[model samples]
Target: MSKPVIIIGAGGHAKVLAESLLRGDQTILGFTDPDASATLFEGIPYLGTDAIIFEHRPEEILLVNGLGSVGDNRTRQAMFSSFTAKAYRFTRVIHPSAIISHIEVEMGSGCQILAGALINPGARLGNNIIINSHAVVEHDCRIGDHVHISPGAIICGNCTIDDMAYIGASSTLKQGVNIGKGAIIAAGAVVINDVPSYTLMAGVPAQQKHQLQGGVK
Candidate 1:
């Protein structure tokens, strides 16, 4: 008797999330997209715009923006806020193929953990976080809200990644490090110390390059 769920987007990520929901034994009530003209995706219908969610008032729904890096993620954040204001309950989506350690893990709502991502025990992932393919969050790490751990990144144990931080592909965070809010670690950067807020750090050993103001690079 799993609750019925509504998917918010109809793009590639939505397709993957839908499959994960199905595998989790949740009933997917189809997707809502402004551009939807097709009858269905993966055997589920495209149910017009997002207004249908308010109309239907399903007991449980998961909203996901399938767009890749939606222009600094402002749009996705707004949508998430709107849904929260509307009293919609969001659920986390974890792919069945992912390997989660038996140790304590706290994952917030609307998290999408992709296949091959390894979440070790004692890790805490905040709301709307994306642990992308092959990313590894070692034990005792705290990942803040809306943080995106890109593919192949490795965060060592006891690290704290603050809200809206982006860990680029193949980057590594050393043990007990703190990455500040809205910080961007470039691809292949190796972090050994604390990264300040709104800074963009890159290269091996991760030197600070510049500061970002209000998501502007």
Candidate 2:
């Protein structure tokens, strides 16, 4: 049998990724976290920080941020860049329970597809993207790199979700809507139009509350 792959991050998100990777026929060597007081999680050892990546020399590693909120998305992007600069390869993980159409779907490394997530045919998922449990990506949706589709969010057909975008829990995107990069759609928002980048949108019809760079509304 091949050696298990390494996983970065040891928090709640990492836990889910670990299980998903295992279910996808990938071995988890261990986890790397800044705080490693705990010995094991889900029966896997919590190794020290990224230093172990160089020592163990696993074939590939998965980058898992698992941090909630859009603010964490920037942090995860930086972390992934740093890891790649150090010449470490990353892997994409998808749970076996998820339903994906046979159409061509492009996914970046370290992506997590949780149980009950349905990705329809012709969908493109970027690197390090997170399709949380039960999220539905309808046909021809394009999800950019590092975006997080919160649990139970529904992305209708032909939607374009830009990089680092966060679709809050249970939010629904109408078909063909374009969500700009780094935009945050609040929980239960029903998006009927395009969302500008770096803005926070909320409410039933999903209107922009404030510009992220300027101030909160």
Task: Pick out the ten consecutive residues of candidate 1 with the lowest summed lDDT.
Answer: 65-74
Our tally of clashes for model 1 stands at 0
Clashing pairs in 2: 91-110, 108-127
**lDDT tens readout by residue for model 2, 153-199:** 99999999999888999999999999998888998999999999988
Query: What would you estimate as the lDDT of candidate 1?
Result: 0.81
Off by over 4 Å in 2: 1-3, 39-42, 58-71, 214-217
lDDT for 120 (candidate 1) = 96
Worst 10 residues of 2 by lDDT: 63-72
